[model samples]
Target chain A: TQLLEQSPQFLSIQEGENLTVYCNSSSVFSSLQWYRQEPGEGPVLLVTVVTGGEVKKLKRLTFQFGDARKDSSLHITAAQPGDTGLYLCAGYSGYSTLTFGKGTMLLVSP
Target chain B: DTAVSQTPKYLVTQMGNDKSIKCEQNLGHDTMYWYKQDSKKFLKIMFSYNNKELIINETVPNRFSPKSPDKAHLNLHINSLELGDSAVYFCASSLGTGLGQPQHFGDGTRLSIL
Candidate 1:
């Protein structure tokens, strides 16, 4: 079974603060995805990194895949209240199934 | 319009009772999945169906059954639910059974067992 571990399970910061979350795995993945889920709602896709060492940026959020395709990181710059949610990292292992991380809960207060 | 939709966003039932959660995707995707999020918010894959065929079935208990009547619909039925079965059930769908395609999710069904 493949497992993905995410660090800093919970984070709370004031507005305009920056935060970074890490996802690590022992097995290689064909693709990695980052999702943000608000309270009472399902997760929404933020970005997908397919190639090793790939980096994708969306506004204030930046996602990077490890060179070995076994790790990923999400960096948020100057986060706002709207950015508060549960951040999940899912790794695709060349199959239709996905292994999701434990998730990082972010609380951004204005 | 909602791309993926799940019925009974909130379900409260007694233990030992049977219940079902319905999911529908209008994105014309060929694959659909059911995930369970525990109280601690740990999400795990329960089942995956591709074009009305069972593809992935994790170590989920037999009491939890998944039925895909067609490409656009996947439903989950639980028999003799227990307290441990209380969790948020999310339904998602992707274009195909391959990597690189992002899966879209529904609002999720929060089940509370008494």
Candidate 2:
């Protein structure tokens, strides 16, 4: 079984602070995806990184796929209260369902 | 418009009771999936259907059956629900059974087995 380990399961920061969450795994994946879920709502896809050493930026959120394809990271710059949510990293193996991480819950306070 | 929607946003029932959660997607996608989110917030895939055909069935129990009557609908029926079955159930739709395609998700059905 492939396991995706995420760091800093819970995070709380003041506005304008920068935070980064990491997802690591021993098994390599074909692609990686990041999702952000708000309270009482389903997760919305933030970005999908397919190649190794790939980086995609969406507004203040930047996502990077590991060089080995076994890890990924989401960096948020100048976090705001609206950026508070559960950030999830999912790895796709191409053959089966995507493997999701335990998730990192971010609470940004203004 | 809601791309994916699940009915009964909250379900409270007792053990041994049979319940069903309905899901529908208007994205005209060919694949749909059922995922369970535990208390620790770990989302796990339980089953997936593509074009009304069962393609991926994880180690989910037989008591939990997923029926895809059509491409736009997938329903999950649980028989004799247990306390451990209490979790958030999410329905997602994808373009196909491949990687790279983003899966749109429903708000999730919060099931509580008493």
Candidate 3:
């Protein structure tokens, strides 16, 4: 069984602050995905990184895939109230199934 | 239009009762999945269907059954619900079944068992 471990289960910061969340796994994954979920709602796909050492940026959020494909990180620059939510990292093996991390709860106070 | 949709956004019932949650995707995808999120915000994959066939079945209990009528729809039927079953259920779909494709998710269904 593949397991993805995420660091800093909970985070709280003031507006305009910067924070980074990490997802690590012992097993290598074929791809990794980042999702953000608001209260009472399902997660929305923020980004997917397939290749090793890949990086993608969406507005104030930047996602990076580790060179070994066994880890990933999500960095939010100048976080705002809108950026506060549950951040999840899902790692997919060579197959179709995805192993999800415990997820990080971010709170950006204005 | 909603790419993926789940019915009965909220379900409240007593323990030992039976209920079902329906999901549909109009993204022309052939694979769909069911995920469960616990109170601590831990998400886990329950089941997955590809091309109307069961592809992945996690360690979920037999009380929870998943059925796919077609490529575009997957429904979850839970029998003899337990208090532990109270959680948010999400439905998602991808172009096929792989890592590169991004799976789109529907607004989850919140199930509460008393």
Candidate 4:
């Protein structure tokens, strides 16, 4: 079984604060994906990184895939209340399925 | 319009009862999947179907059965539900089985067992 470990299980910060969440695994993945899920809703894909050392930015959210494809990070700058949600990282290793991390619950207060 | 939709957003039932969750995707995708999210927010894949054909089954219990009526519809049925089966079930669809393809998800169905 492929397992993805996520750090900082829970986080709470005031508005405008910057935060970073991590996802790590011993097994290498062919691609990594970041998703955000709000309460009572399913996760929505934010970005997909297929290459190692690749970085993608969506406005204030930046996602990076590790050089070995064994880890990934999601950083949010000037996080607003809207950025509060569950952040999840999923990895695909040329298989028919994806391995998802436990997810990080972020609470941004204004 | 919701691209992917699941019925019975909230389901509460007894442990011995049986239930089913229905999912549909209007994006014309060829692949659909069912995932379970536990209380700790750990998501795991349970089943996948491509064009109404079962492709992947991740060691899920036989009590938990998945039926794909067509390419756009996938339904999950659980018999003799247990307390451990209580979780949020999400339905997702993708263009293909490739990991690179982005998946669209529906508002999950929250299943609560008593």
lDDT of 3 at B66: 96
Candidate 1 lDDT by residue in tens digits, A1-110: 89999999999999999999999999999999999999999999999999999999999999999999999999999999999999999999957878899999999999
| Residue B72 in candidate 1, Cα distance off native in Å | 0.6
Docking class of 2: medium
Q: lDDT-based ranking, best first?
A: 1, 2, 4, 3
Question: Candidate 4 on B24-113: residue-level lDDT in tens?
Answer: 999999999999999998999999899899998999999999999899999999999999999999999999997778888999999999
TM per candidate: 0.98, 0.99, 0.97, 0.98
RMSD of 2: 0.7
Worst 10 residues of 2 chain A by lDDT: A90-99
Q: Calculate the i-RMS of every candidate, to one decimal place.
A: 0.9, 1.1, 1.1, 1.1
Error of 3 at B93 (Å): 0.7
**What is the overall TM-score of model 2 with all chains considered together?**
0.99
- lDDT value, residue A72 of candidate 2: 95
User: DockQ of all candidates, in order?
Assistant: 0.85, 0.79, 0.80, 0.79
**Candidate number 1, chain A TM-score:** 0.98
lDDT of 3 by residue, B1-114 (tens): 999999999999999999999999999999999999999989889999999999899989999999999999999999999999999999999999867778889999999998
Give the lDDT of residue B33 in candidate 2. 95
User: Interface Cα RMSD for candidate 1?
Assistant: 0.9
Residue-wise C-alpha lDDT for candidate 1, range B56-107, written one tens digit per residue: 9999999999999999999999999999999999999999998878999999
Candidate 4 docking DockQ: 0.79
Candidate 3: residue B11 lDDT (0-100): 98
Report the number of backbone clashes for model 3: 0
